[model samples]
Target: MNNRYSNKDVDVFAWFREASEKGNAYAQFNLALMYKRGKGVRRNDAAAFVWMRLSALQGIAFAQNHLGAMYYNGAGTKPDDAEAVFWFRMAARQGDASAQQNLGLMYRKGRGVPRNDETALTWFCRAAEQGVASAQALLGEAYAQGLGTKRNFQLALAWFRKAALQGDASAQLNLGLMYRRGHGVPQSDTQAVAWYRQAAAQGTAAAQRHLGVAYAEGRGVRVDLERAYSWLRRAAEQGDVDAQFNMGVMLSNGYGTHKDEALAFDWYQRAASSGHMLAQYNLGGMYAHGRGVRRDPAEALAWYRKAADQGAANAQFNVGVIYANGHGVPKDEACAVAWYRHAAEQGDASAQNNLGVMYANGQGVLHDDAEAVRWYRRAAEQGHPLAQYNLGGMYAGGRGVERDSVLSYMWISLAADAGDETACNNRKLIERKLTREEIGSAELMTRRWRDAHRTRTV
Candidate 1:
C-alpha cells in the first residue's frame, strides 16, 4: 500500500511536469509555484525561475507579474530592475492590477526608469480603480500633495477612506492626520483619535506619536499622562525624532513619571544627533546650565551653532551671546554682531536691543546713532524695558533724535514703571530739567503709552 501511494504521488507530479515540458504555459506556471513553494516537489527557486520565465515568455500575465516580482526582489537570481520593469510592463499592459501598481512604484522611485510622477499617477489610478488597497493609498497621497496633479483634498479623503476601510495602516494614519488638521473634512479630534488608535495598534510610529500628543494635551481624550508617556516611548524606541524630543520633554518636566534629567539628556542627545533642530537647542541649554550633565561651554556652543545653522532664532541669539562673552572661544564682536542680526531680523526682542547697543558703542561696526535709534525703537515698541531706557538716554543726549526733554522723560517714566531702577533714577534727574508744563505733558504721554502697551512676558 505504501509503494502504491508513493507511485500515485509521483504520477501527480509527473502530470504537471509532462504538460509543462509540452509548452503549456498554465502547466509551466503551476509547476513553478509547486517548485517555489515545495508543494508536491522539493523546493528549488532556480527551477521555479526557469519555469516562470518560460511561462512569462509565452504571454501569461500572471506568470509575467510573478517573474517581475522575482527579479525585483532578487529571488532565485540577482536583482535586475531593468528586467523587472520589462516584465511588469508586459503584465501591466494586459490589465494586471498588481503589475500596474508595481510599475507605478518603479516609476515613482526611478527604480528601473526615469522618475515620472505623471506616469506613476496614471498607473496608480488604474490599479486603484481595480481595488488595489496599496495603490489607492498611494493615489491618495499623490492627490493630497499635488504630486502629479492639482491638489484635491476631497479626492484624497475619498481614496484614503477606501484604502483605510480595507485595513491599510498607512491609509488609516493619513486619514487620522487629515481629520486632526481639518483637511478635506470637518475637524474631529475624536474621529482622529479613533483612526490613530487603529493605526497605532498596527505599529505605525507616526500615528503612535500623534496619539500620545493627543493624550498629553487632553485633545479628544481626558488627560492621561501615563498613557501619553507609554505611547511616546513606544514611538521613540522606533526612532521617531519628534517622539524622542517629546520623551525628553516629558522626562525633564516629570510630567508622567519621576524627574530624570539624565534620561532626558539621553533622549535629547539621540534626537539632536539625528539633526532635530529643537533637540539640538535643548541639548545646548542642558550643557550651558549644567543640567543632567557637566557644564561645558564649548559643547553648548557646538550644539547651539548646529541649531542656528538650521535657522533657529533663539539658538542664533544664544550663539551671539556666547561669542560676545568669550564663553567657549575668543571674543569676536564682529561675529557676535552677525549672529545678533540674524536673530534680530527674525523679531527677537533681546537681539534687537543688543544690536542697538552694538551700534551705539561701535563695538562690532561703525558707530551710527541713527541705526542705534532704529533698533532701539523696534525693541521698545515691543515692550522691551531696556530698549525704552536706552531710547530715553539717546533722546536726552541728542545722539539719535532731536533732543526733546518731554519725550525723554516720557520714555524714562515708561521704563521706570517696568521696574528699571536705572530708569527710575534717570527719570527723577530728567524731571529736574523739565518745566512744570513739560513734566505734565510727559506724564500724560506716559499714561497713554502705558495704556497702549500691555505688559509682555519674556
Candidate 2:
C-alpha cells in the first residue's frame, strides 16, 4: 500500500494506522504528517511526535528532519535545541537537504550550538548546491556581508538571483539593494524598483519601505505621493521603523493624505519610541511648538535629550537653547554651554554661534574674546548671518585682533546682504568711519567673498 494519502479518506487513515502500528517506518512518517497537519487525522502534536520519533529511530532521514523541527518548535514536546540539533545532524549526515539547511540555521543563530558562521556557511553551501532556495539566500547574504567568506558581490548576486528566481522574498529584497547600490551590477533604480515590487508583493516590510521611498523620491517611477503613502503605511503597519518615520513626515506635510498633525504626532511617537533619532527630534518639535499635541516644554526637552543622546546635532542645539532660556527647567548657562559645545564640535552653525555668545559674555566660562572670535568665524564661514555680524563687531572693537575698519565693514556688509536688519543699520554706521578708498576696498572684499561662496554652493 502507498504510504502517502492525497485525501482524508477513512480507509486510507485506517490502512496507515494499521501499517504504522505494524512497525512500517514510511507508514509511521506519513501518519505523523497527517496528524501534524490535521489532514486525515485530528491535529495531535503528541501523536505526531510519537510517530515521527519512531520513524526517525528506524533511520528515515525525512522523519529525522521532521522530528528535529518538532523539537525546535516545541510542537509536541518542550523546546530542546540540543535534541533538534541531534536529529538535524542525523538527517544531514544522510544528505538530507532540509536537514542541512536547518543545521545551518541553528549554527547561524547559535540556537543549539556555539554560533559558528563558518560551519553555518558550510552547511548552507551544501543545501544551496542541492537547490534549497532559503539556503541559497542565506549563502548570498553571507557572501555579500563577508560573514563566513571573503566579501564577493559577484557570488552574492549569483546566489541571490538563483533564490530570487525561485520566489524567495529575502533574495529579491537583497537583489534589489544590490542593484540600487551598484553592487556587482550596474546601478539601476528601475531594476531596483522591479525587484522591490516583487518582494513587497510577498509582504516583505523592508522591501515595502524601499518601494515607498522610491515612489516618494521619483527614483524609478514618476513621483507618486499616493503610492508612496500606501506602501509606507503597509510597512509601518508591519512595524518598520523607517516607514513609521516617513509616514509621520507625510502626514505632517499632507503629502498624499490630508494634513493631520494629530496623526503625524502619533506616528512620530511610535517611531521615537523605537529609538529613531530623527523621529525623536521631530516629536520634540511637535511638543515644543504645540503642533499636534499640547505645548509642553518639559516633554520637548525629554524627547530632545533622547535624540541628543543619540548624537543628533539639532536636538543637542535645542537642548542647549532650552537650558539657556529656562524654557522648562532652571536657567543654567553651564548646562547650556555644555550642550552647545557638544553640538558645536559637530559643526552645528547655530550652536557654534551660541557658544561664541556664551564665551564672549562669560555666561558659562571666563570671558575670552579670542575664543569668541574663533567660534564666530566658524559659524560665519558657514554663512550664518548673525555670526558674521558678531564677528564684524569683534574686528571693529579690536577685542580679538588688531582693529581693521575695512575688514569689519566687509563682514558687516556680508551680514547685511543676507538680510540681517541690525547688520544693515550697522553697515551704514561703519561706512562713516572709512575713507573713500577704504569703503571701495571693503565693497570689493564683500563681492569676492559672496562670489566665492556662491560658486562653492553651486
Candidate 3:
C-alpha cells in the first residue's frame, strides 16, 4: 500500500529482540518478509526460512501467506508447490482475502495440485465475497467468459460494478467501456467519462488513452487539447505503444506545444520498435516525406513492408503506391496490385482506389473496366473521395455499365459531396452535374470526419 517495506528505518537486530522476547506475530512476519527480501538484513535463506516457519507456527495469516509465497517462488526455501499450497490453504481458511485469491489462482493454474476449476471458483468466490476488488474482477471475467463457470453477462456486470465501486482502476476502465457502449450497462457517455477520468487520474494507461480520445474529440468531456496531450504523453512515457503513436501525432501538429518533428520521430520510433502497426506506417511516411530525417526511399519501403506484413491497411496501401511508382523499390506494378488488393479487402479506401486504377489501366493485371468499377464502388460506399470520383467517371463514360446520363450525373454529385475536388471541378465540364449544394455538403462531412477521429490528442 505504501512504500514496499514498512519498517525501512528500523534496525533488524533490535527488531529481533522485540520479536523473540514478545513472540510478536506481526514482528515475526515483518522480520521474515524483510529477511526473505533481504531488505534490512543479509540475504540468508536458512535464517529467513527459520523465521518464516516460526511465524507460520504462530498462526499469523500474513505470515502464512508470506511463507506460502516463499515456498511457491522458492525464496529462502526449497521449491515446494505442495507446501506452498498447504500454507496458502491455511491462510485462506483464516479469511485472508489475498490468500483466498492466490489459492484460487493456484488451483486454476494447477500450480501445486491437479487443475480444479471448481475449487478455483470456490476460492475466487470466497475472496470475491470478502470485497477483494481484484478477486471480484477476476471472478467477473471468469463468469462472463465461461471460464470454469456459466457465461452470464448479468453476473459479470454485477461483479464488475462491485470492483469498479471499490476504486480498482482496471475494473473502472472496463466498466466504463461497458457503459459507453451500453453493453450490460445503460449507455451513458457522461458516466463513461466519469469512470474513465477517475482511472486515468490514477495512472491507468488504458484509461489515460481513453481519456485522451474523449478530450481530443469532445466526447463526453469538452474538447481540451492540453489535457488530452498531457494524458497521452503520460501513457506514452509508460511504454504504451498506442499512446506513443498518438503522442507523435500531437508533436507533429504543434497543438499546445511547438511542432517538433524530431520528437515526433522519436515517439514514432518508440511505438514502431514496440510493433505498433500504425506507428510503423507513420514511420514509413516520415521517411518518405523526409519530415524529421533524411529521405531514404529504401527505409520507407522497408517500414511500409514491415507494417504491411502485419496486415496494416494503410501500410499496405502505401506499399502499393511506392512500388507502383518506383519511389523506393524497382517499378513492379504486379506487386503493387497484389498489395492494394490485400489492403482493399481489409477496407482501406485508398488501397481500393489504387487497385481500381491498376485495373482500369491494365498496369499489372489484365485491363478490366468491370473490375475497376467493382473496386471503385466498394471504396465509394465507404465515402472514399478518390474512389467516388473514379466510380463517377466510370459511370459517366459508360466504361463498365450501360450509359445513363441521369445516373451518371447523380454519381458525380455524390462524389463531389464526398469531397473529391476532381469530381467537383470535372462537374463543370459535364453539363448540369453536381450543384453548389453538393460541394457544401462534402465540406461539412469532411470536417466532421476529421474532428471526430483525432489522429492524436491535439
TM-scores, all models, native as reference: 0.85, 0.91, 0.75
lDDT of each: 0.93, 0.94, 0.82
> Number of the top candidate by TM-score?
2
Task: Give the number of the best model, judged by lDDT.
Answer: 2
Steric overlap count per candidate: 0, 0, 0
Q: What digit string (tens of lDDT, one per residue) describes model 1 on residues 234-287?
A: 999999999999999999999888889999999999999999999999999999
lDDT of 3 at 108: 87
List where candidate 1 sits over 4 angstroms from the true fold. Answer: 1-81, 413-421, 428-458
Off by over 4 Å in 3: 1-31, 43-64, 71-96, 106-120, 143-147, 150-154, 164-167, 383-385, 392-398, 403-458
- Candidate 2 stretches with Cα past 4 Å from truth are 1-18, 40-47, 455-458
Is 2 or 3 the stronger prediction by TM-score?
Answer: 2
Give candidates' CA RMSD values in order. Answer: 4.5, 3.5, 6.8
Better of 1 and 2 by lDDT: 2
